[model samples]
Target: MSAAQIATGEIAVGQLDLEYVVAARLTLVAHAHARGARLTVNGHVAVNDAAIRVGRVHGITRDRRGFHVHAVAMINVIEMAPERAVLDAGNTILGNTIQSNGQSGVAVCCAGVTNNLVRQNSISGNGAAGIDLVGSNGVYGVTANDPCDTDTGGNDLQNFPVLNYAFDVGGGVIVNGSLNSHANTSYRLEFFASDVCSGSGYGQGKTFLGSANVTTDGSCNANFQTLLNSPVASGQFVTATATDPNNNTSEFSACAPVIAFRLLSIKRQENDVHLMWTTLAGKTNIVQRAFSPGGSFADIGPMIILGGTGQITATYIDIGGATATNYYYRMRLGP
Candidate 1:
């Protein structure tokens, strides 16, 4: 059955498995199609084999990935935590401290939520993603799942607040927007730093991918419309194309006609900070220095937190220096 067709929340009340869920491959949806699905469980489930699997695909003909282990089962019983229901389907997980168990937190695919107003939920301990925004766009987004479950949940409500990011994020947050935003539209993705994420991947790459007049913060950057028709840097060859998961030339990873260098500052925290950042296809190499207005930077070894594979992530800890002193910093990129 399709994920969108079988998103059932018919739990066995107090019983772990009042029935049996046997399928070589299972599709995960928001809730198959149940209303008011709140997750709240504490215990163990008996999948026998692959009782509860995460990340769904129609079926892969090639050898399955190690992340996809094999098991045997008949009466697979899963018990979830209290007040925790699977977040709709198609996940684009972009939060902190997420843990994947059998069946407890969520069972997402690609494309998680957007512009979530999270506060302080421990996002790293869930069975699936603490908070994901995966979608059916497939290679169109981040991961791959059965597009069949596209009708899992509604995309209106914002999500939980995760301060840390120590778990796994198939689709790390994409900052600096991308190379293909319209003149009037703004694409923003924000995150709350914490012990889990520890300020992972901060200002690691481009905030504004296009070449033109715009504004940029350490966390975000904007691009102008005309910049899309300009020339690149002298001898600086960055392969440009209108390709992406969705082939939307005006998308985050889409290649604009040109690009320009811009700076983005980091969000200041009262305590020790954990930083993170992402690099799409066409963006200037990130140059992060600690000392302000021209000072030395902290050495982070070779590779300077690169984003070669299209998406790069980095983590750093601030010892917290005096207010008047110039902190250390550094930068790197495709240029």
Candidate 2:
């Protein structure tokens, strides 16, 4: 059956396999089986802007995507099983916004629903998880005895954040990273630093800076900061990984190089103030000076280069500073 628009109150089908090809905003009170009826929803706006008391149940498959399921101000938006029945393998639930349901947004309670992709959708503001893998009965291989076969990856989980990119090394060699995941879920974030960007020792020969267990806030984002046991010179490569409470670990994110300069010491010599700092060899830096700690700073002189290989300690003398007056100094890696 196909339609440009369709609206109904309660739909109960008997023991027959049916396919519905809908192309417009379709509203329904419930989609269920009276005597083993199998249903498939197809077309655009398949079920949009409706108050579905019991969304869909018992062997119902939503194959045609781009469907809008919103304003559901009720219980489950899409429930997989009422009794025990395995959903079809390779069946997909894609690009649908399942939100504002009183219970879970989308629940896959049946087994045998393998190789399915639930990606690029917004699922949030529900009583439970955005997507819950439940039930143990049926031929899906995920039963009460063994429920670990469910794979819920590759989805842009709203309110459930995943690590995006590692950027910015704050507080002198300490690595600061960010992530997106479910709110209040415990996550173990591990950081690794490498000297080489690419080639032989590329992702290899990495030093474990450490790991932190961070819980996401209501916004489903986290800013984790961890100090490295050993300092990493400027231009060193850094990357991170994350593990959820279920011990499901994600692959390492793209590598980001650390760009930081350490100010070592400052000495007053007559009218000139001598400043010394450490930086990676072959790097160029600029020294700036301010009258007070929080005051605006100005560049003292031309760019200085720390030539050759390996780490290097360089010095810059501020010869124009006033005598016996306080002067603050800092160095930043040149762009």
Candidate 3:
């Protein structure tokens, strides 16, 4: 097409699917300048163009709640300016492989760009973050997570999920993390895996694993654990994002590497305790003990085991293990 296909004015477009749309300027522009103007673009491949643009433009009324861009691929650079593959959302950007763009893969720009759900997408190889939420300070990239997520800008400056650990079991991956956000709110958490973290140090969703829904407590805290059936091997990295009840999505969390170690079993025989764990080859394991769940854990001495080349089960025995009133044991991959 000589000019970009434009969707404007007050109308409801059901589905706009573009295959091989190429242009020097914008390929598809969905501007919600008129009230009740709704659009959904899906199964598209836009290269050598500004690709797909969405939001309120032209100093007019905003669009309604039906704008969505999903299941598309927007790679290749046209470098007109620092333009994102998709921008300025009060909508959803879901299940899109947006990579190597001139700017961010997807960005929610400026104030009042709320309820933009960015989920289930492999967003990487961009110049900026995979999902960039403009901070209240008018800066780009990941805004530091504030207490209770009170700060506001793009997507209300939504706080991303901080992962405690990601472990690759034999069958699947177990991911554990927590989200601190608006009180008594339900949020959607999406997990992704990457071979390496993005340059920005926040992260990029290289491979979408799975998603879970969590509701925060009165203290604005939600602890979640999910088992992802996707094929994520040990040594790969995992990341996650949080989308609030308003569909406002946050940036990718800092990458957490998938660990190959797991504390399998613990048994007590009289005053002795036996511990068994799955360990990676040529890796060192450390055992720690604590009295309470929230208490400090100290390393148990003279019990470290060095693993072999194959995945093997290692065992350690603690003499006089019943000396303490209560005991908790944990193992970690050591040096």
> Judged by lDDT, which candidate is best?
3
Pitting candidate 2 against candidate 3, the one with the higher lDDT is: 3
> How do the residues 1-335 of candidate 1 rate in per-residue lDDT, one tens digit apiece?
34322233333222222123333333222232323322111222212112233333332111111011112221232223222333322323222222333322322233442222222122333333333333444222112122211232123121111111111112122112222222233333222222221122111111212322233334332332222222233112121111112211111111211122222344446654434554334334444556565655554434443345333444454445334244545444532
TM-score of each: 0.25, 0.35, 0.62
Residue 272, candidate 1: Cα error in Å is 38
Model 3 pairs whose backbones collide: none
TM-score of 2: 0.35
Candidate 3 lDDT tens digits, 1-335: 22233323222334444444332233332333313322322212223333344322221122231123332223322222235644455665655566766567776666777788887777777787788888656676767898899987888889999987677877788887899999999998999998877765678878989899999999999998888898798878899999987889998998887776677889889998999887655556788889998889998876465644545678888889877799998876553
Name the lDDT of candidate 3: 0.68
Judged by TM-score relative to the true structure, which candidate is superior, 2 or 3? 3
Give the local distance difference test score of model 1.
Answer: 0.28
Report the number of backbone clashes for model 3: 0
Q: Pick by TM-score: which candidate is best?
A: 3
Ranking by TM-score: 3, 2, 1
Where's the lowest-lDDT run of ten residues in candidate 3?
58-67
Alpha-carbon RMSD to native, per candidate: 17.8, 17.1, 10.7
